[model samples]
Target: MSLAWNASTDNVGVTGYGVYRGGTLVTTVTGTSFTDTGLSAGTAYTYTVRARDAAGNQSANSNQITATTSGGGGDTTAPSVPGNLRSTGVSSSSVSLAWNASTDNVGVTGYGVYRGGTLVTTVTGTSFTDTGLSAGTAYTYTVRARDAAGNQSANSNQITATTTTGGGGGGKKVLGYFVQWGVYQRAYHVKNIDTSGSAAKLTHINYAFGNVQNGQCTIGDSNADYDRFYSAAESVDGVADTWDAGALRGNFNQLRKLKQKYPNLKVLFSFGGWTWSGGFGQAAANPAAFAESCYRLVEDPRWADVFDGIDIDWEYPNACGLTCDTSGPASFRNLMSALRARFGSGNLVTAAITADGTSGGKIDAADYGGAAQYLDWYNVMTYDYFGAWAAQGPTAPHSPLTSYTGIPQAGFHSDQAIQKLKSKGVPASKLLLGIGFYGRGWTGVTQSAPGGTATGPAPGTFEQGIEDYKVLKTRCPATGTIAGTAYAHCGNQWWSYDTPSTIGGKMGYSKDQGLGGAFFWELSGDTTNGELITAMRNGLG
Candidate 1:
C-alpha cells in the first residue's frame, strides 16, 4: 500500500510523521509519503498521520482515510476488550488510569480512553493520566483496543475516580486579576470578590494598575486606589471604613481586611498595564532605581500589611503595549533581575507577559527565559492572539490551543507560542496558560467557522469588538468549538470566547503539558455565580 498527502509545515520545519493503522503505529517517516507491503488483500485499513518537529512538538492528528485490499483474506477480527480497567491514583487535578492489555488476531494498535463517555484522547500505552479535573469530583473512565484491520474492541469495564479535594497544592497556583477600573461602571469592587466567592477559590489576586510613571511605580488612580470611601453596604465584611486618627480607607483597606479573612490569599500590586506601559522604556534604562521605587511603594507603611508581593505587569520590555518601547533585548532580563534582587527571595515576584505567539513575535523580542529565574512563574498572556482589530476581519478565536486548517495567520496560536517558549528553554512548570475572560467578535459575519469574511468589529458593552464572557454566554451562546475554544454566531454577530467546557479542555492541555497553572484576564468577566472561575479551579485543582 502507498499513501501520499499534502506536506505539513511548522515554524521550525516538520521533522517526521507518525503513520497509524487502526490502533497500531505503522512507521514514523521523515518524508511526506509512505509505502507499505505484506498486507493481505481485501482487508480494510484506516490511517491517520501526526507531524512532529525538532522541538518535540507534535501536531494534531490529520484527517483519517480508509483503504481496502482486493483479496479480503486478512485478519478482520477486532481486538478483545481491554480488561481490569482501574484507577491507580487520583489528585486534585489529575487521575491515574490503567487497564490490562488486550489480545488481537493480528496486533493491537493502541487504546482509546474516554471520560464521561466522550473520547478525550488516544494513547499507545496501557495507562493514561487524565489531568485538569475538578478536585473532589467523580469521573468515569473506560478503554478500548483496536486491531490493524480497522476493527475496534468493545468498551472496557468502567471505573470511577474521585479526585482529592484541594487547590493546586505545593508551589503550583491559580491566580486571578481584579481590575482597578472595575469599580467604576462595572461596579465590581474588592467587596464583590467576597460576594462572588472568588476569594476562597484563588491563591493570589493581582490588584491591577500600579502605574509606571517617570520610570517608577506609582499609583494610577488615587481616588480608586486609597481615597474613595466605601459605604457600609460596599464593604467586604459588612464593616465600614473608619475616619478616626490614622484611619485606613478605600479599596486598599478593603483588600487588607480580605487578606485577614482568607489567610492564604496573597494580593500583589500589579504595575504597568496596557495603558500605563509607556514608562517601561524609561524604567529599563535604570533597573536599580526602578526596583527601589517599586519596593518602597509596594512596601509602604500605610498598606504594608495588605500586599504580599509585587507583580510587574510591564506590557512589553523591548516591544510595544500602549506605546512603543525600543529597549534592547537585555533590558527585560536586567529589570527583572533588579526587581528580584531588591524584593528578596522570600517575596512572590511575578510578571504578566505577552503571548504574541508568532515566530519572531513579541515573545522573541524579550528575554523571558533569562529572566524566568527571577520570577515565581510567568503569567503568559496567551489570549488576544486575534481580535476584530482589523475592521474587516477574517474572524478567529482569541485563544486557540492549536492552529486549525485555514487559520488566518501563522504562529498566532497558543500551542505554537508555548512550544516556542519551551524550545527556548523556558521550563513548562514556570509557565502559566492565560485565559481571556471575554470574547472578540466581528459584525456581519456570514460564515461561522474561522477564516470567514466579516464586515466590521462587533458592538460590545464596554469596547468595540469585545464583550465579557458572562454576556456572551447568554447573548450569543457558543454554537461551535474549534482548537479548544468556544464560539457563537447569533444574527449578525459572531463571538468567540472560552466557555466552561472549553476551559476544562484547556486545563487538561495545561496538565498534559506540565504547566504551572491557569489564570484569566480579570474576575468581573465571569458570571455572577463565578461559574467560569469555578471551572478553572475545578480543572486546575
Candidate 2:
C-alpha cells in the first residue's frame, strides 16, 4: 500500500501513521487519515504519525493525539478572560459595552456580561448592549469568556457605570416621620428610645404630638410624663411648653430649638395618627373649627414663629381608621382648604394618606387628588398593604411593583398605588415613595425564594411577622429583584425587604418615573449607625 503522512517534515519519505492502544503500537496505515477497523468499541487510544522513507528510514513521532472513544468529547482547558472591558454608550434606558477578544486553548466561543450581579446578556461578539434599565442607575458589570467545550474563564475586573439623570428635573420627594412617642424624653423611655447615634438621613421630621397638659392642654407640669414631654418639646423650640399660651409663645419656641439643632431640617406637626384620629370627624364636620384648632395647636402664640408647617395624619378622613368618621370626601378638602387659607403658601402643608390603591379604599374615602392642589406634598403610606388578615396562603408581598404570575393579590403593589394616584391627576413630583422600616415575613415556607407562600406570617421578637430593617438586613440579605423590588429567602422562612442595592435601584426608578423622593416609616427602626438611611441619602444623590 502507498504510504502518506499529514504535513510531516523529515528526511525520510512518508510511509504510514502509527495507531497505538494501551501504549503499544497496533497498526501502520498508508493514508494520512486512517480509520482503524476491528477496534473494540468505547476504548481509549493514543495515536502518533511518523514518516518513513523508501530506504526504510523512520522519522521521529509527531504530536500525540489522545481520544476517548466515548459518547462525548471533553475539554480540559478553560477559555481566556475577557479584556479591555469598557462602556461604549450610556443613557437613561440602555448601556453599550465592549471588550477585547479572548482566546482559548481550543477555541473561543462567546462572552457573557453581567450588570449589578445580574446576567444581562450573552454575545458571540466582543460587544454587548444592555437595555431597559432605569435612568440614573449605577451598574457594575463583569465579563466572562466561554469556549466551545463549555469551559468559562474567571470574570474580568468589574466596571462601574451610571445612567444619565435625564432632562425632566421634577421628581418625587419622600417626607419621613420622626415619631417621638414620649420615649426619647423620659429617662426611662429614653432606654426605649434609641438615640445612641446621630439622626437618620431623613428629609423631614414630623415630631410627634406636642400636647403635654394632663387634661387642660397646658404645656409645663411637674408630672414625669408631663415634665419629660414638656422639656423635650421645649428643647426643640428653645422655650417652655406653655399651653393655652398663643402660637408663638409655646410650640413655636420648641420649633426654634429643633431648627437650631438641625439647621437644615424641616419640622412639621403631625396632627392625628391612630391615637388622635377621633377628633378628625368633628374637625372635618366644621372646617373653620378644624382649621382653627390646628392653627392654635400648630401656631400657638408660644412658638408659632418656629414651626415651618403642619402635616395632617388623619389616619383616614372619610374612611374608618382607629375610629370611624362619617364625613365624606369633600370634608377632607374643606379641612385642607381652611388650613391652606389660614397658613397660606409660605408654610408647608402636607398629609399622610392610606396606601390602599383601590378605588373605594382611598379615592372614594377622600378627594386626595383634589386636596393635592392645596398642599405641597402628599405622603402615600405605601406599606401595610398585606398582613395576617387574609386567609392562610402565601405570605404576600407588602409592596409589589406590578402584578406577576401567581401573585396572590391583584392590585396591591406600590406601583399600583402610585399609578392610581397619578390617574387621579396627582403629579409625580408631589408623590413620595413610602418605604417600611421593617419587613413582613412568614414561616413554614417550603420554597427557597420570595414568590413562595408561607403557612402564615412568621413569629417575631417584638411583633409578629414584622422585623426592623436593621435585623432583616443581617438576617435575610435580599438576593433577587422582581419588578424593580428586592426579596430574599432562607430555609422554610422567607423575607421580602429592600437593601442598599435594592434601594439604589428604587432611587433610579424614582428618578425615571419623575417621582419626588422616598420616605421611610420611621427613623428608630434603622440601625444605630443609620446604614440604611445613609444608603437612601447616597442613593438619592
Candidate 3:
C-alpha cells in the first residue's frame, strides 16, 4: 500500500515525514509519499503520517486512512504455451520481443520472459524489453505463460538478437542529448540518468554545446563542466567530491562515474548548436587547425577518458541559422575530412545535419553526401520543422513524421528529409531519426484541431510556446493524434508532442527505412522515470 500526506512546517524547517501503521511506527522518508509492501492478502490496514524536524521534534499525527491488499487464490491447471514468439526490435543494450497470447483453465495471469534459458522477468503483457546486455553480443530469448495458480506453461519458440556494435556502428543507436545548463534551472543531474533508469537503455550520450570560437574548440561553461562540487547525495556513485587540489568535480566527474557504471555507453562532445554556429565559418577557413585544436581539447588529460569521440552540431553549414553562412557547399565536407584525418579511425566521427527536404533548401546548401564517407553516422535533426515561432495561429506539430494534407510547408516533414538525404547519396544505414522530448503550442484557439488560428504562443514553464512531456502529459492531455504524432487542446491552449505510442510508430518507420536508430532532442524533458527514452528503447528493439 502507498500512503501520502500534506507536509507540515517547523520553526527550523521540516526534515522528514514519519509513517505509521495501526498505531505503530513503520518507516520515515524525506519525501511526502511512501509505499509499504509485504502486506497480508485481503487484510485491511490503517495508516497515518507525522512531520519531524532536525531537533527530533515530532508533530501530531494527521488524519488516518485505511487500505486493503488484493486477495490471492490457488489453482493447479497450467496455462497453454505462448505461440509465435519473435524479436521485434534490437539495440546496443536491449532487445524487444512479442508473442501470441496463451489460454488457461483459470485465466492467464502473466508471461515470464527468459534470456538464455533464465527467467528474467514476469509481465502481464505479451511484450517485454530486456536491457543491460552488452554491445556487439548475441543472446537468445523465450517466453512461457503463467496462471493464477502459479503454474507456468512450456517455453515458446526461441529466438536470437545481436546487439549493435560499439559506438553505435552498423545497428540501432539510442542516443540522448544531455544539456550542460540542465543542472542549474532544470535540476537534472547525471545521477538522474541512473535513478530514472535511462542509463541501461542508452547507447550514447551527446554532451551538447561545446563552443566553437576563433577557429578553435572551447568549453561552454568551465564552472558547470568541471569546477562545481557535488555532495554525496548528488553524486552518481554516492561518494562526494573532495576539495583537494586538482580533484575533478562537477558534471565531468559525474560523467566519469556514469561511464564506469555503464561500460558500453559512449559519450561525445557536441559543438555548434543553433546559437553558436557563427564560428563555423572561421573553423571552416582553417579546417586542419580547427581539427587539431578539437583533438587536443577532447584528448586533454584532465578528462580525456570521458569521451569516445566528437559530434559536430553545426546548425546549417553554408546556409542559415541564427546567423546565415556563405562558407560555400564544400566547407562541411572539408571540415569533416580534416577531423577524420586528425582523430584517426579509432575514434568515432559523427554530425547532426539539417533535415530540410525542400528542393534547393538547407539540404542543398551543403555537401552532406560527400561528407558521409568520413563519418560513422548522421543524427538527422528531424524535429523543429514548425512551432509557435510563427506565433499567430496555424497550429501544427513541430515533429510530424510524414507529410499530411494541409501541412504549412512542403518537404518539411521527417520522411521527406530522410528521402532527400538518401537521394543525395547518403546511406540509409548512417541516418538516425530525431524525436523531440518536448512540444510546441499556441493559445486562444477555438478549434481543437490542427490548422486552427491562434492568438499567440501558449503558456509554458520556461518558454512561451514550448513545454516538456512530463508537464503536457497531465496539463493538456492529448485529445487527438495527427501525422504520426500526438496533440492536445485544453480551453484555448493547443499543444503537439510525441507520446510513447507515437514513438513506437516512429521507431517502426525507422526500421522499415533501414536507418541506424532513433535519438531525441534532450533528456530533461522526459518524466522522472524516463518514459520517452524507455519507449524509444523498446520501440527500436
Candidate 4:
C-alpha cells in the first residue's frame, strides 16, 4: 500500500515523514509519500503519515486512509468510522473539533483528519485542533480511524464550520435591557437609544420578552419585532422606515442600525417574561425541540443579523412565578444543557433568573449551579421583593441593596441574593446584578421614610404602582435612605427607588464583589440625559 499527503511545517521546515500501519511505526522516509510491501494479498490495512523535523520532533499523524488487499491476511478487519463529529470552540484563526471514538475488533489505533476536502493531519486521540487558518473562512471536516491490525475505516460524518468574525462579546459586559412593549405605550422609540447615550455604553442588550408558548419560543409582538414603521422624527437617524423592496420596518431593523453604529453592542433575543413564563414547563418537557425552534426564530433570515444569541428567561424553574411548574428539580439544568448543545459554541447563551434568596425560597427551587455551565451569565433580578402586590399597610422599598434592621423579609435584598447565588457555585463574574430603572410606590402614605403606612398602590402615570425614574426623582423627591435605596413622601404618597447616588453605591458593590457587571430592568426609565446608566458605567470602571 502507498500513501501521500501535503507536508507539515514547523518553526523550521519538514525534514522527513514517518509512516504507521495500524498503531505501530512501520517505516520512515525523507519524502511526502510512503509504500509498504509484504502485506497479505487479500486483506485490509490502515495507514497514517507523520512529519518529523531535523530536531526529531514528530508532527501529529496525518489523515487515515484505508486499503483492502485482493487475497488473504492475518488481521484484516477495519475499525468502525468515527461518529458524532462536531465543532466546539472557534475563532477567526482556529477551530476545535471533537468526535466519538471508533471501535474495532483489534482496537482502534489512530484517526485521520481532512479539512476542506484535503488531508490535514492525523491524531491518536478522538479530537483535533486545526490552527493557523484564515479569518472568516468556511471549512468542512471529516475523520476516519484505523485498527491496530492495520485495517482502515471509512470517512465519518462531515461537519461544516465557519470561523467567527471576531471574538465573544468581551470587555466589562455592560448589559442592558430593551423592552419591546416600551415602543407602544411608553413611546420609547429605538431612537431614544442614541438620544439617551445607551448605545455607546452598552456592550449587550437583551430584547425583552420574545414569549414562550406551547412548548416553543415565539415572538411576543410581531408588529413590534418587524412591522412597526418609524416616522422620520422617531427613527434613530431622522429617516423614515421604508416599505421599499426587502426593507425591514420594526424594532429589529432599528436594532440592526444601532449595532451598525455601535458594532460592539451585541443583542440577544430574550424569550419569556413573568407573563409568558407559563409555557416554560411545557418547554422543559421537550427541550431539544424548544431549542431548535428558538434557534430558528433567532436566526430568521429577515433580520438574522440583528441578534448575537438567545436568552432564556424562565421566571422560576421548578417553582411558581406567574404559573406553577411541576418540572423536577433537574428540569432547568436539562433544559439549559440542551440549549447549549443545540446553540453550539459560536453564540452566547444567557438567562434572567429569580433572586429570592431566603432559605428554601426561589433559589432552592431549581438547579442553577448545574445550569451555570451552559450560560454566559445570569441576570439576577434583585428587585421586586416587596411591592404593592401585598396591597395595604406596610410600605417598603422594593429594591433594597442590603438587609436593613426591621426589614420585613429576610434575604430579600440585593446583596443577599447576589451572595446566595455566588455561594451556590455560580461565579460572581457570571452574575449580572439587576437594577430597576423605575420606582415601586404606595399611595396614602403619611411617613416619609420606608416602612410607612399606606393604603394601596400609588397612582402612577401609566401603571398603578410603577413610575419611571425621571418622573419619580422630581415628583417624589427622595427624602430618606433605607437599606441602601431612596424613598420619599409627597403629600400622602410614598415611593422607594434607586437614585443616581444609590445606583453609584450599588455599582460599587457590584465591582467589589467582582461581578460580571450590572444590568438594569430597562433603558427607557432613565432621565433624558441617561443619568442612571452614566452612573453605572462610571462606577463599574
C-alpha TM-scores of all predictions: 0.73, 0.60, 0.69, 0.68
CA-RMSD of model 2: 19.9
Best by TM-score: 1
Clashes of 4: 9
lDDT of 1 by residue, 148-186 (tens): 665778999989988777654323467899888899999
Which prediction has more favorable lDDT, 1 or 3?
Answer: 3
* lDDT for each candidate structure: 0.82, 0.63, 0.85, 0.81
lDDT per residue as tens, model 3, 428-463: 688999999999999988888788998899999999
Q: How close is candidate 3 to the true structure, as a TM-score?
A: 0.69
Candidates by TM-score, descending order: 1, 3, 4, 2
Off by over 4 Å in 4: 1-171
Kindly report which residue stretches of model 3 are placed more than 4 angstroms away from their true locations once superposed.
1-170
RMSD of each: 12.2, 19.9, 18.5, 21.5
Better of 1 and 4 by TM-score: 1
**Model 3 residue 342 lDDT score:** 96
> Candidate 1 or 3, higher TM-score?
1
Q: Compared with the true structure, what per-residue lDDT tens digits does model 2 show for residues 186-300?
A: 2222221224332334557665543312211122211332323345433533344545523233223444554566676677877677776666677766777666666776676
